[model samples]
Target: MTSVHDGEATALGMAMEQSAGTVMIRAYVAPEQMGDWTIRVTAIEAQVEHATPGLQSYQLATDVYAEQQQARTWTVTLAIPRVLVAGKAVQLFNVVVGELPRLGFLTRFRLDALALPEDFGPGPGFGAAGIRQRLHRPHGPLLCRAMRPAVGVGTDTMVRLNRDVLNAGYHLVKDDEVQVFADNRAFRQHVEAMVAARDEAQAHSGERKGYLANLICEADELAERWDIVKTLGVDGVPMSPVLQGFSTLSMWRASGKCRSLPTTPSATC
Candidate 1:
């Protein structure tokens, strides 16, 4: 059974308890801001039961506040009842703070892990089985390469670099964290250049792909950046979960109903 502590406005250091059969849950949520906040806490099973000879358990949780608030926080607790530990191996959950849904992946179980879900885009390039089904190259691990551009590089310079990256057989790329500000390099120029490079590579060797550009704009002017990027056309944009807050990014991704998106880590989001 799934236990969801769904709510709108919340406060700090609030605790709750829940039980499913013999399994028990103790959730503590300490909200950091006003406006809307969403938090989730779940207990999962740990594998290697026979070797460990005990129940393995862990919890996943996060909190989101408004943009004006700067940052938000929360905590979660899961109590095991000796029936069946929540999980045996990895515990996965699709947590949604407002509209942005992030896949929470748990590896090593400790007291807790930061549930601050970063935007990996609206969703994966392909879902679990979907990636394997489409790319047909999913059995092995994947590598990620970030395009850390020179802070002052002009748009044209960055575009040429995109071409070089695509030529080097790098499967994926994303813009650096400091690459957004009132169009110093011009988002339009960057998108057009990268999209064209992506097309050219496909035209010859038939390797069709591109990179996710970091679109850093002021909260007051994010819409303008989105519109310009859409008009120019690119695969996706990178939003930071830490700096912008989760709800802001959630709404941004929601605005693009039919387009693809990716996100990076930051302070708020």
Candidate 2:
């Protein structure tokens, strides 16, 4: 018999067993297809065992249904037995949305939400507290500066802008997500110049500041850029995990090179 975790948060708490795996995903469905959706969603997610013995499989355990748009729209919240995905967020997404297209029961559907177990990855290496400490701004709103016209802006221009911002009392400055490994603006030179500007500004402003350099590059080149940032002693770096892949960010955090400096995840422009 399949274990059904019903109710709301209370049942979710009760379903948390060491051996029991579970995850919650919300999908929209047509009002008429709720019955078939309940049956197929559960079986496809959890019932089909993985070909590999140790690999985890999900079963649709329970669902919460709701009506919206004057009963014109229907949404279902599916409680699935948790399946662990170690390295690849892409694989995790595959598990969530891969089977839906094969089953043509729902009219229009979207994977809207995901709830993972508490014991996930290393979490954030430097969280808000750490970022505050690094920037030397313990309280009040944090000020941020961004490098505009990211493309074709050479290292000299970037360093000059950072210098102005640092002197103008901006606590944190970041490279635009569009700024990747470019010929005109190389990663190493940009970081080196930013570091130089930061030191020069600190001497005058007497306030500590940080730089979140952009590391949006090819998947294979992520590690190389991360190393450049660390080696050049850049204060921090901004990573576009959606574009560069979340696994890259995970590797950077686990690399232990960014332990002292903070790493921020940015969305692709």
Candidate 3:
């Protein structure tokens, strides 16, 4: 049964419970429309409760300080059932904020915070420790460089840029997100060239140098791109999970095909 929490403290406690995921949303309402907002909130609550299965509870709270300062801040805390997400990124997003914008009465809303059950997705496939281990650096900062001149550069130029950076003692070098792959042939060639440059740098420096291929492409091309990079032995990949969609990234990480390769998430989010 769905329940409504009365206070932020209580809502926070519910948020930490193992059985559910919690999200805190902030909404702004005009002073003239307070009454209308109240009515809308009640209606939206009922609608959400009915439409969202595994919705355990929710709460609406006013920020007293913000109200005094005329900021009009109101917060909503939602406790959703854990089973609904099941370690899937898309499902987690859907259950939390997918239908929010269309619910009306909230011209301005922001997701302030989110708390997931401890066992979210398969965590990071190769996190910081894994990267450090692969690079043979137990501590200290690892220098990484992005192959720039974001666009309009040919494969040879990119290869030269990567080779220079890797040779300059940078631990990792990756393609800029904006770099275009005109076709599969072009992309394969780019990867091959970059990997060869990385190997050469590693050989000369007597240290491991990593190359991360940017895998931002058409949805249909993701699998092929992954196969190419994996087969060619690139150290890692730079991906835009936000642009690719969380589900695609999650699927790839959980697939175990690239378990040994570290993934660097691009700054698209």
Candidate 4:
């Protein structure tokens, strides 16, 4: 998939200099608006007879930009997995701006592999046993949450629910994906109330809890709401995988705008 890296932690480009395999695809996203850039890459000429998760027809593209004080053009080419066929020896590819990431976006016909930036983080330090050993809570069922849409429940109700949920011993409560509109009491309002409840509950029970409000707004409004949530000092917020899109999440994780982990929730594509 060809995606734009708005200088975030997850936007990476790798270009091999005669097998360079590594030079990040540089983007020039304005700090104020880390916009999504549709990339143009390779695609399939025919459907494969047999394919798995990674072996499928695709058209990828990414826009490359000149870096600061640099004078070279950057590009990337991906080696097609030995599964799908393009009906020809080679194909042309380039970026095609569309309403969404699309199959027809590959028009430049260039080789694969762009020097995209890589995101880094601490790897899993402890397996299940290790985590259990560290926490010393190995004798109970693993905790999980049931996610529900955050719509219909106005801000006041959500605030009350957040409080009640924490008081009832649930460790995590988040706004569902369907809760991003500002007309029915904005997300900021709920976040403020939720934070207060979390603080109160933690003080009373000496147990830490969180309210992950969903950040499912349009890309234009994403960072703004994110800033509001972060400024309020809330512990967490949720993001819809479909609304803002993964490129946005990648950029979010790439930059620390949403903390170490602004939770990513995906609507199945």
Candidate 5:
């Protein structure tokens, strides 16, 4: 939890020490294009400079080629001004590897590492401890389930599934990422039905159970969907941040609506 002042001081100190903010990027240059890698690096530097204002300096590390290895790779490390990315997740990502893939010089580009001065992103609304507290499970595994048959099912079928799994001791259940509001049954009706089923199961079992509605919709509908979940007292939500964009998750976390409702990010890859 680095404070803003501390981050600022650290950034200033790094600049004075000629290091700046530490952000490392790694990419594999095509073997045939190795000779022109410097030009690519120059292009990258120019792009980074344009993208990151107030960036103090950057350096490209020595190229590494293993003996008898065909693949050649370069590591680029730089220190950016902390203010540029402080508390900004999307900006941080953009500054690091936004358009680097579009450079068309590297065979493969990867973000190897990142060092943030402060708690840069909208962190988890309810971390592990909070989740445990909410679920009333102080120890042991908190079992979770994803509703199957993501599509082609009515709200009644989904509700029955929720009730059955929750009654059988599952701590949490969520909608699959493929389940969208529009393609499936009415979003509000489906969510409300599932929530009701969850409540009934919890009351019968005398244990806390959670329901996470899939809230992956268009950008304009995100807030509205979130509001529906919150208002209906759905325990949490499952979202595909990569598909929806990381900023969507950041916005949700920052909106103050996620204080009690937990979010699970569905895997994209």
Candidate 6:
């Protein structure tokens, strides 16, 4: 993790500095318009310092190559200042989307992926280690299942269903993002029910089981609910990066508030 205090956040310096501040984005451009696209990207690169003062522009490769998706793929790596992010994941989103939209090919371009430096955030806090730990199966395979018929089931009913699965030797059970967290199926009710179910399962099976509650909510409400889920003894949390924004996961990692907890990203992302 390169400290943002090392020097002024110059794009070139950061990009060249062990790839600390580099953020890679894959974009699609037309084969014939490669030259024009290159110029546009270069111009955007040049505008970085102006767009974000104190953050110097960095060098990037502009070679255009064809991909299996029938469009030419152009990988652009931007070196942004670490200070600007200040450990806030949303800043990464701003760094990427803020400048790229200025290009004329915005409509034709498709952002395929983002490759971030490890210092950026502790990605997928639980990951393989956390998942295995949650299952208490250090040397064996872990199991996971989601609550079916996604919606319309009451909180109590969902709890009983989850309890049954856990007692049946399932390692973990998660709620569908759409099933709860809405007006009718309140988050508090669902979390309380889940905690109760987990307790019952543990007492009955004599083995640990995990519950991944949906933490999908409006941005303003997420922090509050996340804390509640943790304090209430839920095993893990499931969130939709697309809906809640990727920064949400970043915040969870960078904030150090949920370091011990595991998070399950919505499969749709």
Best-fitting candidate, measured by TM-score? 3
Clashing pairs in 6: none
TM-scores for every predicted model = 0.48, 0.65, 0.69, 0.47, 0.67, 0.61
Better of 5 and 6 by lDDT: 5
Give the per-residue lDDT digits (tens) of candidate 1, residues 1-269.
11122211211111111122122234533333211222223533322222221222222344521212321222334323222212211112212121111112211112344332343234433344553343334566433366655478776676667667766665555677676555634666666676776667546545545456566567766677667666766555666644554455446545642232333464111
Best by lDDT: 3
Q: Write the per-residue lDDT of candidate 6 for residues 1-269, one digit (tens) a residue.
A: 11111122222332333222223334643445332212111212221221122223232333331211221223344544566455555666655554543332222223446655676555445567766776677877677778986787677788789898888888888887676565423777778888899889988988888888877778878777877887788877667766888665655665675453323455210
Please list all clashing residue pairs in model 2, or write none if there are none.
21-82, 22-81, 22-82, 42-60, 45-58, 46-58, 46-59
* After superposition, candidate 6 runs with Cα above 4 Å error: 1-88, 105-107, 124-126, 182-185, 260-269
Please estimate how well model 1 matches the true structure, expressed as its whole-model Cα lDDT: 0.43
**Candidate 4, superposed: residue stretches over 4 Å from native:** 1-149, 183-185, 258-269
Number of clashing pairs per prediction, in order: 16, 7, 0, 41, 1, 0
lDDT of 2 by residue, 77-161 (tens): 4454334344345656654555443331222334557776765554566677887887788899888888887778677787888
Which pairs in model 5 have colliding backbones?
A: 21-79
For candidate 3, list the clashing residue pairs, or say none: none
The 0-to-1 C-alpha lDDT of every candidate, in the order given, reads 0.43, 0.57, 0.64, 0.44, 0.62, 0.57
Residue 110 C-alpha lDDT in model 6: 31
Per residue, candidate 5 scores C-alpha lDDT tens digits across 166-248 of: 99989998888788666323788888898999999999999999988887777778767777888898877766666788666
Q: Candidate 2 at 233: error in angstroms?
A: 0.8
**For candidate 2, what is the TM-score?**
0.65
* lDDT for position 49 in model 3: 22
> How many pairs of residues in model 4 come into backbone collision?
41
Model 5 vs. true fold: TM? 0.67
Report the alpha-carbon TM-score of model 3 versus the true structure: 0.69
